[model samples]
Structures are given as C-alpha cells and as structure tokens.
Target: MDKCFYRRGKVSLSGTIVAVGIFMLIAVRGMGQTGNNSVYRLTIAEAIEFSKSQNKWVQTANMEVNAADEDRKDVIRAKLPIVNVNGSYQRFSGLTLFTDGLSHATTGERKPTPNSAALGIDALFNIYGGGRQHALEEEQHLRVNLARLNAQDQSGNIALQTATQYLNLVKLNDLEKFLADQLNRARFRLNNINALYRNQKVTRSDVLRAEVNLSNVELSLEQNENDIAIANQHLDVLLNVPDSVIIIPADSAGMTKPEVSSLLQLTQSAEVSSYTVQKAATSVDVQTAKLRSIRSANLPNVSFYAAYGLNYPNYLFFPPVNQAYSVGFVGLKAQYGISSLYHNKSKIAAGKIRVKEAAMQREAYADNVRLDVRSHYVKYVEALRRIEVNEHSVEQAEVNYRIINNKYLNQLALLTDLLDADNLYQESRFNLIKAQTDALSIYYHIRYASGNL
Candidate 1:
C-alpha cells in the first residue's frame, strides 16, 4: 500500500510539472503574438491620426496651447476680487510701557509678558484701472488664440509629413516589386542562355553577358531593399513606433489627384485660411492691445479693501491689556504714480512701434503664403502632366520589350538589345510611379500651404 501511494504521488507530480510547462509555453507564445500583432497597417489618414497622437513635436505644441489657455484664465482671475487669510505669532524679549504721573506714584513697578498672536482675513476688489485691466484681458485672449493657431499649424505640418512619408513608402514598395520582377527575368534569361550554350546554339560570351546582367539586377534589388528600409525607418520615427515594427501601407494605390484650383483662387483662400497668416494677424492684435494697456498706466487705479482681525493689547481709543478683541474696517483708495506721466512716453512709443512691426510682419507672412500656394499648385499640375507622358512611354516601352524579346529568342537580336529594351520598360514604369506619387504629395502640400489639410 505504501509503495502504491508513493508511485501514485510520483505520477501526479510528473503530470503537474508537464501541465505547468505546457501552460508556460502557451503563455509565452501568446505574448509573442501580441508583440507581432503590433505591426501597423495604416493608410495616410490613419498615419496622420497616429502622428497627431504620438509625435513629440505635436504634443509639445499642444502643451503650449494649454499653457496659453491657463494664462488667459490667470488674467481673468486677476480681474476678480482677491481674498486672503493671514496669521502671525511673535515673542518679544520685553515689552515697554509708559507710566503716567498718577500711575507712577500709585505703582512703583510694572511688568509685562511678550507673547502675541494675531489672525486676519482681507479682501480687495478692483473698481477701476483706467482700462488697463480690460486691455490686458484682451491681450491674453489674443495670445491664447495665437497659441491655438500655432498648434493648428504644427498639426498641419505633421499631417503633411506623414502623408509624404507614406507616399514615399508606397513608391519604394512599387520600385522594389519592379526590381524583383527584373531580377526574375534576368535569372530566367541566364538559365536559357546557359542551356543554349550547352547545346552549341549560343556562344560562351553570351552566357557570360547574361550572368553579368543577372548580377547587376541582383545588386539593384539589394539597393532598392535598402532604400525601402530607410524609408520605413523615417516613417517609424514619425509615427513614434519601434524601429523593428513593420508598417505596411494599406493604400498602395496612392492618393487621387485633388482638383486643381486656379492660382488666384488658391492664393485668395490661403490669405484668409493659412494658419501662419492668422497667427501673424493675431500677433498684431496682441501688440496693439499691449500698447493700449501701457497707455492706461497714466490713469489712477481705484480699489476697495476690507479686513477683520483680532489683536492682543488693543491699541484703539480704549485701553485694554492682555485681552483679545475684534477689529474691522472698510475703505476705498485710489493711487496714481505721478512719475508715469514723465516716464511712460518712451514706453508708449516703443509699444506703438512694436504694434506696427507686428502688422508689417503679418503682411509679409501673407505674401509668403500666397507664393507658397502658387508654387505647390504649379508643381502639382506639372506632376500631373508628367504622369500622362510617362503613361504613354510605359506603353511604348512594353511593346518594344516584347518585340525585342521575341527577336532574341529567334536568334535575330543581340542579348544586349533585349536587355536594353527591358531596362527601358522598367525605367518608364518607375517614372510613372514616381510622378504619380509626386502629384499626390504635392496636392496634399498645396492643401497644407492653404491651411486646408
């Protein structure tokens, strides 16, 4: 019975260990799958979304916007009534008292304790500040708006970057496919040439030429793959993803060309819609408000204040010793700095100059935006034209390649001629892909320049 029990316990222990091992294996595999599943299959829109959420620059700009909002709130809160509570404790080495003639004769000596404590609550309400407060409030509001516009501009820039990278990845992917196909064709040709050489139908030099062609095609394929890897790294940086994470572009077909607006229309829209222009305009308003705020310094400020407190050794009209008593008062006050009348002229002039400078800066920025819009619009149009031309070139090259290939097989054309035709066809295809991607990228860029993206 003891042996049987021991044997059963051993069997149970082995079974438990195996079960645990299997569970651990499954858990590890599940973790691996979770990591692998992190790969992103993103379209341009999705990439933009991820960039807005993850890109460090965009996040920094967003923080600036939040800081501006808080500044505005601080300015507004400063305009409201201010309230505070304060307390103090003190212990003096000695207290001094003056004795009247009668008290000096009646009591020859006097002693005092030195401990004291006091607490108070006070409130102040601004009645007027010569419109300085209002001007400051307006200035803060404009600053907040400026910050928001800056963040919007940053977001547009990030979107443009994501779109550009995404488009380039698609182009590289297409190029890689092209190079792969070319490599395969080279391999096939080399095999055929080798067979022909063995059967005495082709010379050894022809086989050597085919082998050299295959090696060059292989080298091109490797270079194309390196380009793809670099492009992927750039995109990964933009998306804030791990460099090892593969990002497969879901929309390999590329973006459609946006409708081309006339230069006049694009420029007109950019003038009003561009974030850069709007930010510059807001800056002008802020500077103007600052000038108004500076001018208000010449006027007197009015306020009302009240306080309630307890004190030891009351020092009011009635004499009380070592007793706590409540005291309260309310009053209105006005203050004017007479020196401001003499000292503020230069400051006001400087403020005015700053305002003028801001306005001029705004005009300059608007002009630049117009030029940018026009430049991108022209590029997009030119790209479209190139795409049309490349399309026909690809067709002709394909036909030429077919004719040359047939001649090569029939021993009527040199291997070099066939290889040249194949290269032309491939080059035409690559040019078409490049032009199409360029047109799409430029279209998005135009929208970004117009502040529409």
Candidate 2:
C-alpha cells in the first residue's frame, strides 16, 4: 500500500509539471494571437510581402529602374530641336550696333548708331546624324529594359530569401513543440523510475539514468529555444519589423507542387520569362546600338538650321541708324569629320567585337537558365520522395517506441532499450519535420529558377 501510495504521489507531481508546461504554451500562443506589441503571429505570405516592400536590395533595384526611366526620358528629349533666345542693348562708344566695328573705321562717325535693342529666337534641328541619334535613343530604351529586368530579378531573389527564412522559423517552432512533448514524456518516465526505486524493483543506477535522460531533454529544449530566438530575430531583420516584436509563425501550408508543363515547354518559357536571359539579350541590343552609333562617325551629318536674332542697330542699310530690329532666317547645314573616316577603323572594329561578345553572353545565360531549371526540378522530385520515406519512418518509430515502453513497464525490456527507442522516435519525428519543410523549400527553388517567384 505504501509503494502504491508513493507511485500515486509521484504521478501527481509529474502531472502538475506537465500541466504547467501546457499552460505556459497556451499563454504564449494567446499572447501571440492578441496582436500585442511583444508578440505577433506571422504568416508566410505576409512576411514575404512585407519583406519585398522593406528589403533594402529590392528597394534599391526599383530605385535604379526609376533612374533608368529618367535617363530614357532625357534621351528622348534629344529629338527636340536646340533652341535659344537672345536680347542685347548697347550705347555709343560701346557701339549700339557694331557691323564687325567696320562702320566706325569707314564712316568717321562717333558711333554707328546711338542706343538700340533687339531680341529674337534661334533654332537648329538635326535632319540626319547618320543614324547616331536613332542609335542613341535605342540604346537608352534598351538600358531601361535592362534595368527593369534587373529589378525583377532582385525582387524575386529577396522574396525567395524571405520565404526561406519564414519556412525555417516555422520549422524551429515545430521543433520547439516537439521538444516540449519530449520533455513531458521524459518527466513521466523519470517519475515512474523513482516509483520503481521505492519498491526496490530497479537499481539506483536506473534512477540516475532516468534523471540524466530528463536533464538531456530539458537541455535539448533550451537549445531549441535559443535557435528559435535567433531565427526570429533574423526574420525580424528581413521584414524590417521592430526588434522587440516576437514573431510566432503560423501553421505551415502544405506544399502544392506547381503544375509544370513539359520540359520542352518549360525551356521555351524560360527563354522569354527568365530575367537573366532577358537582361543578357538586352545587353546584346545595347551593344548593337552602340555599334551603330560608332559607325555614324564615318558618315556625314545634316541638320536644319533656323535662326531669327536681331542686331542692336540697322546695319544692313548703307547709313546705319539706331533701331530695335527683327530678323528671321532659316537654312540647312551639313558637316563631315574627314579625319574620322580614317581614324574610326579601330573603333568600329572594336564595336563589332563587343557586339559579338554580347551575343555570346546572351547565349551563355540562356544555356545556364535551362540547366538551372533542370537541376531544381530534379531536386524537387527528390524532396517529394524524401517526404514519403520520412513519414513512413516516423510512423514505424512511434509504434516501436510504444511497444518498448510497454515492455519496460512490464519488466520485460531493459531501460536502455526503452531509452534507445525514445531517441529513435524523436529522431524520426525531427527528420520528418525537416523533410516536409525542405520539400516546400525545394518547390520554391524551382519557382525561383523558372523566374516565376
């Protein structure tokens, strides 16, 4: 009766401890759900979206895209005519109207004309620049495209990173719960071992071993808690949230493998959809446009010139008079750099080589993208297989642990055997958690590689 009463007392104490652990868990979860400053329940989608808006790399890339668009606008303005307005007033001695200062020399007059003022507009529009202007505008357009592609690529990268951290935090949360359960079980086993010790059914070594097992579980819990803290802080940095905010991850979503078309179709899709490939192609276009611009050096340039600007005095007549004059004229101007026809041979050759290099670079990027897609798809398939295997392993380990625990209670199995089974069970569960999270991560990797992330 005494031994039985002692067993009841031990069970009661252990039950209280387990209840307290559970209560703490519930309280923390409740705090997380209440949207308090100290605790927050974060979902995967929310984390990713917030990170994109706040991530430094993503913001910088978008800013670069804006700058490139501004540059494109500046280039477009080149098509507009160069225009200017001028006005001048002069007094005698300073020459109100000076016909190259020849009126004073020829007329023996104090000044060609006393005070005079005039104002007009002058304009020059490029009629032809041997395609240089067209090439320059085209280059700017290509640059804008390049910047946009780069921004897309960077945004996708940041999103992928955010998702990765969110998933990792979810994994750590699962591990924490698992460790808590393990701690409760270890506590129960230790209490039973102590009861057995009271009845002299087990040696002192068994009680010592049970205490060691409980300590190990508690230590494992502590270590897991530390990991969760680190992961939480890292995620906070990613989302740009306040450091004091504690993020509790919500339930991890089941992985839905995206429906992929045939490999042929995916390859074709990547050719147009992949930012890396598109950026490389844009580089090729930029180089080709630059080549065109360089070729223009050897060609003559033509422009339409129209200038209507007045002189201070009426100098066109034989006898100059003080007046505010209005003049209007227009003409065509042509120019050729005779030296460039011979001097640009090396430059033109270099430009052609760069164009070829750009084309080669584009082809290289396309090939890499195809290879990357294939690699990720293979990993995704492997992750699925791992998930199936790990799930079966967990089921087997749980059953084995149950059988071993029963046999030990019946005095048929050794304590070491029970402990080994417990460890196996925990390991299987851990592996299964990682497998599930890894499978989802690999799916996202495939999405990233295909340029759909």
Candidate 3:
C-alpha cells in the first residue's frame, strides 16, 4: 500500500498497483520538456511520496514527534536516582574552634588544622512522589503518541493535496489532447467546406461558417496550452522542486474504483484507524495523566538518600581532630508541603475540568470525522454514478456526431448541424474525463477524511 502511510493508507495489496499500472499505461504520457528547462517526470505515487518528505507541515510534525520522544525519555530518567561526587581542597587563613561554648579550654580546641581536603558522594532517589513521577511519565508517553498521530495526520494531508493537484494537471492535459483532436476535425471540416464552395456545391456562407468554427477551436487550443503551462509551474512549486526544474507528470488517470461496503463500515473504520480521532483520544489520556499528576501532590513526598564523606580535622566530634575522618549514612527522607493542602485543591479541580474538556473534545473530533467520512463517501458514490452517466452521454454524442458528419457529406445537413454535433461530442468527452478525475479525487478525499490516505 503506497498508502501504508509510511506507517495506514494501505490499499488493495498487489491488485491496486497492477491496476494503477494499467490505468497509467493508458493515461497521459510525458508532456515532454518545457522550453529550455530540465524535464522531470513523476507518477501519482511518486508525487505523494515527495509531498511527505518535502511538505513543510509534514516536516514540522515529524520534528515534533522527535521532540516528544526525547521528552518521554527525559520523563523516564526523572524516575532514576541522582548521584553526585564532589571534592574540594582548601587552605584556611585562620582556624577557630569554640570548645568553651559547650565546655572549657577553648584555646586548646582553637589549635586546629590550617589546611583541609574533603571529598563526598551523595545519591538521592525518590521513594515516593504521590505517584506524580509515574503520572508524568505516562503523560509524556501519551504526548509522544499524540505527536506521532499528528505526524501521520499530516502525512495523509500532504499526500491528499499532492494527489489532488496531480489529478488536476492530468485532467487538463487530457482536455488539451481532446481539444487538439477537435482542432484537427475543425480544420478538416473547413478544408472540405472550401472544396465544396469552389465546386459551387455550397454557398460562401457555409465556407465562412467552417472558417469561423476552425478559428474557435484554434482559440480554445491556445487557451488550453497556456493553462497546461501554468499547471506545470504550480506542480513544480507543489513538489518543492528547484525553480530551474519542471516536473511534468507522466500520468493518465486510471484510478481503480474504490470498494466501499457502507458508510457505517467506513465510520467504524475511522473510529478505529482515523488519525484525528486517535490524536483526540490521546489528548484525553494526556489530560487525564496530568490530572493524576496534579492530584499526586496531595500525598507526602518521600525519598531515599545516601551520603559518604571524608574530611581532615573532623568537626563531627566535640573537640576538633587534626586527622582525616570519614562518615557514611543512608536513610529515607519524607516531606509534605503544608501550602499544597490548600493550593493544590484549586489546581486539582481545574485539572479535573480539563480532563473532561479533553474528553469532550475527543468526542467532537470523532463526530466530525464520522461526518466527514460519510459525506465523502456519499460524494464518492455520486461521482461514480456521474461517470456512468457521462460515459453513456459520450456514447450518444459519438453516434450523433457520426450521423451528422455523414449527413453533411451527403449534402443532406447544414454545416451548422455538423458543427453543433462536433461541439456536443467534444463537450461529452470533456465531461467524461472530468467525471473520471472527480471520482478519483473524491475517493482519495474519503480516504483522507478517515485518516487512511
């Protein structure tokens, strides 16, 4: 599935690829190089892939995911103990010890070491944080997931955009080809009219009519050529190609008809797979985790601490010693914030509100996702029906054109009648091509709405 989204838009396994291949085989070929520029050819799948890598929104989303992952790692590290090894050397200007403050003989204790060196190691690990650490880790993990979902959503968006633009370019190219065909027919009609007028079989009015028709087709062809050129430049910008490079799609739209069972099925699928819904759901989890973290402040904080130190002229004794001494101790420490009892109350209440808000927001997004999926599916069905309708119209117009062309050749029909038939035929062809492309567009839009694209 080119749509396996780099990660969820997986399409019909091998069948779709083969179908696309066959369709493109019959679709438009390369438009050749634009004047004096490098010709870059692209297919629809290739265009979508380019959009994922080159589109700024997708790039930004990917960056967010990376940052979120790093954050999650940081949160995990927060649970680990902090260890420090510290050392210092010092020469004292004067040493003073006050033994007479607690006993007699102050002068004897005052004869202390003039220099000292000390080293210490300490480790502190949280024994308890009212479960705040775990909650924080959970929130960070969910945020990382949320970021990933956002990235998937962005990838789907860019892919859909690229596909839509690519299809538009293809539709215009198809029209240009059709119009060129009509232009040829117009010239042939005009030449035949001139021959008939020279033989005095048709009036000059008829010849003038044919010439006017030929000019009209010429003007239309010119307009389409210009549009195609503009489409080329737009595509270059869309693909994020260098200004010096032009991307001409080697495409002939051959989108396989999307197989959908029902709107209910799609809605259900979206609930399970949709990135928008998933992101919203993750948001709820994030908020819930945050609330838990906030509530954790209600419990007393506790930690285990261990420290070992060596120092000259030990100060732990009543009389200061000149020799070095070492001490090590390990114990648990506990603390409770008296202010948090009151301060945390409002914060927890607000946190609870936010959790509810987040849940409601998830529901809202899920609702919109379902609606979007349903609407697109309906449009897809309509587009498919239109393609059917336009196809029959094309058949009828083709027959009508043939009949009128024959009648005009037999001198049994006016030039105006034949020109009308030609116009109808062209219009019908244009409509069919348009319907085909529209159906494909709607199909992808449906996928995008469900976060599958």
Candidate 4:
C-alpha cells in the first residue's frame, strides 16, 4: 500500500513538472513554440547542487581562495634562495682607463684601455633580515586562513538562500492548492444558486453574486500562477540556469520549526568559528606580524651572496684577457638603516594602531553576534507561534466553510456568507503555509548563525 501511494505521488509530481516545464519553454522561446519541447525538471537538492557548481558567487569565491593560496605560496618563496644570471658589456668609442692598484703597473704610465665587460650568475640566500621574511610569511599564513573562512562563509550564505527560495516555491504550491479548493467550493455554490434561480426559489441577484464570487476565485488563481512564475524565474537566476527551466521542489510540510531557543548557545559556538570572526582574528595576527616587521626594520639584514660569471669586453661575448673563465665568491652582506629614526617611525606607529583597531573590532563583532542571535531567536519563536495559530485557524475556517456551504446548498445561507467563509478558509491555509516556511527558514538561519552551516 505504501508503495502504491508513493507511486501515485510520483505520478502527480511528474504531471506538475510537465506543466511547469511547458510554461518555462514558452517563456524562454518567446511564445513562438507551440509546446513541442521535452520537459526537464530539478528537485530542490538538485537545484542547490547546480547552483554550487554554476552560480557566479560560488565560482568567484573559489577564485578568491585560489588567489590567496597562490599569494601565500609566493610570500613563502620569497624566503627561499634566489638565483639570477648576470651579464654586462661595455664599449668605449673614445677611451677607457685602467690603473694599477699600487699606484703604477709595468711601465708606470696611467694609460687608457679600450673597453671592459663582466658577466656572472649570482645567488643570494637570506641568513637573517630582522625577521622580515618570517613576519611576511606569518602574515600570509593568516591571510590563507582568512581566505578559507571567507569561502566557507560564502558557501553557507548560498545554502541559506537556496533553502529560502526552495521553501518559497513549496509555499507557493501549497497556496495554489488552497486557492484551487476554494475555487471548487465557489463553483459548487454557483451551481446551487443557478439551480435555485431556475426554480424561482432565489433571486437573480443571488445567482449573480455567486458568479461574481467564482470569477474572483478564478482571478486569484491566475494571479497566484503569475507569482509562482516570477518566483521560479528568480530561483533560476540564482542557480545560473535559464529562466525558463522548471524546478520541482519536494514536499516540505513534514519539516518542523527550527529550535531557536538555544540560539544564544549556538551563536556563541558559531562566533568562535565564524568567518567574520576568523577574518578579524587573522587581521590581528597580520597586524602583529606587521609590527614585528616594523620593529625589525632597525636590525641589520644579513645575507650570503655568491657569484660566478663570464665577462666579455666590448660586446665580444668574451673577456678580452680571458675566455670561458668562471669565478665564485661567497661573502656575508649586512645592511643597517640609521635613518630609520624618522623613516620607519610612521610605519611602526601605523602597525600598532592597526593591531589595536583589530582588537577593538573583534570585541565589537562578538557583541554584535550575540545581539543577532537574540534577534533571530525572537523571530524564530514568533514564526513558530504563527504556525501553531494558523494551523488551528485553518482547521476552524475549513469547518466553517463546510457548514456555510451546506446551508447555502439547502437554501438556508446567503451566497455572500458562503463566499466569505471560503475566502477565510483559503487565506488561513495560505498563512499556515507561510508560517511553516518561515519557521523552518528561521531554524536553519539559527543553525547557520551558530556555526553549524
């Protein structure tokens, strides 16, 4: 029996999918196609997967993470040994001079040499640089964490948005069902009034009123269809699909309201892992590294340098005195900046200020997250209450509608009363569905806020 029921549900869902697909094709084709395209459909889960793969925001977020990863690697590489090929050639059309180191050479005459050149491969390894390289590496490491957090945040946001849109579609479907049932009831009343009028038991006004009510129900149905179409288009845009693509959301009625009373706990937990918090924390680390870098600015930078090269004189590609000669020398290089008293002071001051600012912002963020948790918790409870109240109201409205409808059929109730009851019932049903949607949405938001997203 369960299998049969499941099969029936599948058939019903398939029919709905086909209808939406046809509408989508018409919309995309500009009404030129006479409904000849095969229908394609996606469930809420499938749609979310598609969005993650094709959505522009997801792609852009991933790109940012990739770029940060590359940047971090680049910074680390800066601390590694560097190798470069060096070459130089000089030509003197007029004259070049060469002098002995000990005042004179050979003939003791200071004479002009034609030209000279030098070329070599040089390598430099940083032995120490007041921890500048280390500071930069640490900063980049924090940046890598910041990038990952940002990507995670973006992913979570997408999940929330997709859940909201999917729920909205489900709500629309529920609302349409409510309106359909009301329209059916209205048509039934109109038939009764028409029969009464024919038998001279009711006035023409009574029959006309029933007709008007039925027409109004039909108009409401048309309006609802338009709303659903617009909603589907919006979902398609978010998913990066063609606007005409039909999406079929699964039944969401079974879902319960999110437990948001524990929002404070969740928020506290989530804030500890939140992307914004992580980014801020990383900012502090980065700024601290900057301070270290600034403080090290006054310290001497030590490096090991070595070079071996071939020198050519006068662009001849070889030294005039020697051909294919290689020489290598290793030396310790150190640089001290005495002018740092004025030149580096500003940077040190800026680094300190940034570190302090990050600390303050981190504290502010913690407070804001607590407030947000409290606010959303209230919304969550209110939505849950709405669901409960609307649920009961819809039941009462349905019963009232049935009672009024029966009286109208028995010539005991006015047409307006029947119409009013039917409208009330339908409205109650819509509100119930909306409340349910909100309850579920708020729960997920609370979960997201608490860091479970």
The model with the greatest TM-score is 1
lDDT of 3 by residue, 1-453 (tens): 233223353222263354345434433343233333366577777777666666667767878988999999998998899999999997766534556585643332233677778899999999899999999999999998888888888878878888888888888888988989998998888888888889898999998888888888889889988887777777667656666555566667555565556335655688657888888888889989999999898899999999999988788776777889999999999999988889999999999999899888888888888888878777888888888899899999999999999999889998889999999999999998888888778777777777767
Model 1 RMSD, rounded to 1 decimal: 13.5
lDDT pick, better of 3 and 4: 3
lDDT of 2 by residue, 1-453 (tens): 111011101112354355345434644775866856477665565556556556677667778888999999999898899999887775655323346665643334344655767788999999899999899999999998898778778767776787788888878888888889889999999999889889988899999998999999999899989988888888878766678877776646344434334334554577667878888888999999999999998899899989887777788776776554667888999999999988999999999999899899988988888888777767767777877798899999999999999998888899999999999999988888787788667655655666666
Looking at model 4, report the run of 10 residues with the lowest lDDT sum. Answer: 1-10
Given candidate 4, what's the lDDT at residue 265? 65
Locate the minimum summed-lDDT window of 10 residues in model 1. 1-10
Give the poorly placed runs of model 4, Cα more than 4 Å off: 1-46, 94-115, 257-265, 312-326
lDDT (10s digit) by residue, model 1, range 100-160: 8545533222223366778899999999999999999999999888887887788778878
Comparing 2 with 4 on lDDT, the higher-scoring candidate is: 2
**TM per model?**
0.84, 0.83, 0.82, 0.81
Indicate the residue-level lDDT of 117 in model 3.
87
When summed lDDT is taken over every stretch of 10 residues in candidate 2, the lowest stretch is 1-10
Q: Report clash pairs, candidate 1.
A: none
- For all candidates, the clash counts are 0, 0, 4, 2
How far off is residue 366 in model 1, in Å? 1.1
Task: Give the Cα error of residue 115 in candidate 3, in Å.
Answer: 3.3
Give the Å error, residue 252, model 2: 2.0
